[model samples]
Target: MINKGANDLGGFLRSRRERLTPDAAGIEPGVTRRRVPGLRREELAELAGVSVGYYTRLEQGVSTSASDAVIDALAAALRLDPAEHEHLRILATPRRPTRPRARRSKLRPSVRDLLAAIPGSPAIVIDHRADVLAWNRLGHALLAGHVDFDAPDSRVRPNIARMLFLDPHHRALYRDWHAKAQVTVAALHQAVARHPADPGLEHLVGRLAVDSPEFARMWARRPVRTCSSYLRELAHPVVGRVTLVNETVTLPDDDQQIGLFYARPGTTDADALILLAQSFERRLAPGTPSRKEEAR
Candidate 1:
């Protein structure tokens, strides 16, 4: 039986193993009923061409230094996709002294300007901790209209992951909250593995774990997910239902990711975005009463 020890890698391995059946791994089930779930330690070790003792040590967090060939073999045996394979590699890699991570990461002015260039679509730049670093007007309107448009310019930036779990408005925005929650939590895990020394990311994870039971439940799953592009269904307060393709690209120079969300041209979804833009424009027009003013 595979058990997760104190190690994150061990936890991840345990989660993966639980989901993979012996029949799926092409192992014939014996007539004897199994007591523990998933492929046994010895079975997986045999498939990876490693001794059961060494594999057990690796899973138990006693030994983390696994060869590339062994990682590759294990990945193949487990049928991991590209992103999952990369995540596994990061977990197994030895930790090194990393430079201090700033709480608010700066983006080149050119990139910020680029975000504004696409007026029709919504775009945002976020750091590894999922803190909003910069956002286009439409992006702010779509994701966080309740927030000040210039919130990202401040020292204390709003974190998307935090809002997703804790803020009721943000939680209501997603049509499928569970799906988005899972992906967000998994991304956090990936970030921690890649940037082991990032204090900001560390704090975010700790904060969410304590404050949000939903986040805590998802975090315990030891998920690892990296998505370049996905569809997001939003129940926008102004525009009603919206389906947009969220495309994210990692900036080469830094760990920041820039994402643009847009719908296919000429669809009702596009029309919904157009309506959202119009409402936002009117709200920001000259002499328009602000949310605070209206509240007063």
Candidate 2:
């Protein structure tokens, strides 16, 4: 088996180097001999304030304990964006001294209650790996009408990012698939940085890269984006067209995140959302009692 632990560091360094050109780094390419487009090893070393031999060792995965300052210099030398800079820190940091605790998989009852109380808004809580831990009825209807809300922990549960890239339903739901795809990839890139040792996350990324050519291509570009707040234009099958402002808030006590979706106060989209909620309620009425009754 490939030592993915070391390969990740080496792969990232090689990719960053190949992405830059000698001219871009203000280094003249010698007419005599040149094998690569980017700055040579010596040039990158000089720019990053390290010896050529030391830089080579780092790239070859021989040296893994680089200081934050050194990694920052390397990032600056590579012309990394915010996302890439963060990734470099993650990759260069030494392995944890102690094994990390297994992430808690269950959502707190209080959090579920909060989601249920948001009657008009659609909201969900996701774990660090972007697994859907829980969602309100409206959230289930808005994001994955075809998925089973009662079985969130099931393997069949929908992943927002995975659906965006692999599922045809998501492709049709978002008006601008390219834009949504970029954000999804960027968010995944950030998540990878935060949890580099997570085997489950690694497997998911590998599967997506292998299965979707589009995902593979975008992953190579190494775009980094954080989606704290954004507007989503959703083409709901029942609601037709609606624009919702999405916000992601971190839970105070855990690594869970809550995503909330809201429409403007007095717009046609808001009306459509109300109609969609009503339709969703009707659909669920036969299977279970009213949401209020369930709470009681």
Candidate 3:
């Protein structure tokens, strides 16, 4: 019996196959018209050194137990990048069924301290669901000062994906909101493949799809992307436009959490960050209501 995972794997393979053209794969387009949009199954099988019948079975969800060598060869034939290769591996493998239990999605105290120790850089830690688990003072100010730093523990947690679309404050925070939205949706797509059995992730996706038409459209496009270090421009209300290299580091000890670090050295952008930090310090003064409280 083909399981949901196997079916999803087959669909992903078919979608990827349809994305490549015969000419792009260095194959003759042929004099006759082609019925398939991209490289045919037989052609892909030949490139991957597998029999056409076996490849067909793989694509049809009849064979889900592909060897690592076969998976690697297929990834090469498809010309997949690092992120795509990782997504392909996730689809081909089945996730072990998770027992129904409440899992703590909190950051470690030591990690929180480490985030605070990084003086000049704005940093925050996020869980697998993109919930801001913990952040330093500057990070809180730069990203979502309007939302409480302790919001992650509350019923209304600050999910990056949710904020990107639903929250006007978060949308206005980005200088290039469209580009950031595309990346955010794509990363969520990859996460769905990685954690197929996670109900929380499923719920988040479903909720966004229902609430935001833009998100629904993007989700339908099936963009697959994972996060990486890249230059980001932020339209910070207090400090104005700020540019920084945003790098997300995955912790091996706590795979569920990713640490996002932002830095801009020796430039006005650095000065902007310092000003933002100072503003956050002012917000913390005695008898001063935080930005979060002022909004209430």
Candidate 4:
């Protein structure tokens, strides 16, 4: 019997394969024209030191006997990054019980302290589901001042992926909305693949697909993006135009991470961040309700 998981593995492989170009793979272009965008199945099979028949069967979702060595060769031939390689392994692994594993969403005390330590910088702790577990005052103010900081941890917790596509305020925050949206969707795609048996995540994806047309379109594209340090331009309602380098610190032995948003020290954007932090601090003083408390 053909395994459905193996079928998905095949599709994932094909997608990654198509992302590579023949020239990029060090293949010289011949006079004979090719049809597809990337390297042919035979070309890839040869590069991975596998039979063409085996590679073709793998791509067609009809083969499930690929060994670890074969998968590693395929990854190397496709030039997959660390995250992509991990993803490929997941797809190729045999699926057992679909029961969801216990999700660890609680932020460590040290991680929470780390967020408070970075006053001037906007930082947040998020789970694999992109749910904002905790955020510094500046982080709340910078990203979603209109919403409560405590709201994320509340019953109706706010997820970054959900807000990117569904919330008007969140959508307006990005200067390049479409580029940011694409990245957000692609990252979520990776997340979904990472936690395939998580029913909650599957529900989130289904809800987004039903509610947001743009999300459905992007999700259909099956774009895979691994989140890393990247620059983002935000049109904050309070701070106006601000650019920051968002760095993610993947927690050790945990599924949560702290995302720090900071501008270059000597720049005007850095100055803006400082000002925003100060404003949040002032709002937290006696007699003044925090933006979060007031929202409650």
Task: Give per-model CA RMSD.
Answer: 4.3, 3.0, 4.1, 4.2
**Candidate 1 clash total?**
0
lDDT of 3 by residue, 110-167 (tens): 8877886885788888876777777776788889999877676577578899999999
Model 3 clash pairs? none
Model 1 — TM-score against the truth? 0.90
Comparing 1 and 4 on TM-score, the stronger one: 1
lDDT, candidate 4, 80-158, per-residue tens = 8887787777667766667785553676777777887877788988877788888888899988888876886677678
Instruction: Show the colliding residue pairs in model 2.
Output: none
lDDT of 1 by residue, 99-157 (tens): 96766688788888788788899999998889998888799999999998777876689
lDDT of 1: 0.83
Tell me the deviation in Å of residue 216 in model 2: 2.7
Q: lDDT values of the candidates?
A: 0.83, 0.78, 0.78, 0.79
Q: Give me the runs in candidate 4 sitting further than 4 Å from their true place.
A: 1-7, 21-43, 62-65, 79-82, 95-98, 102-104, 225-227, 282-296
TM-score of 4: 0.81
Model 1 residue 99 distance off true place after TM-score fit, in angstroms: 4.3
Superposed Cα deviation of residue 175, candidate 3 (Å):
2.3
- Ten residues in sequence with the least summed lDDT for candidate 1: 1-10
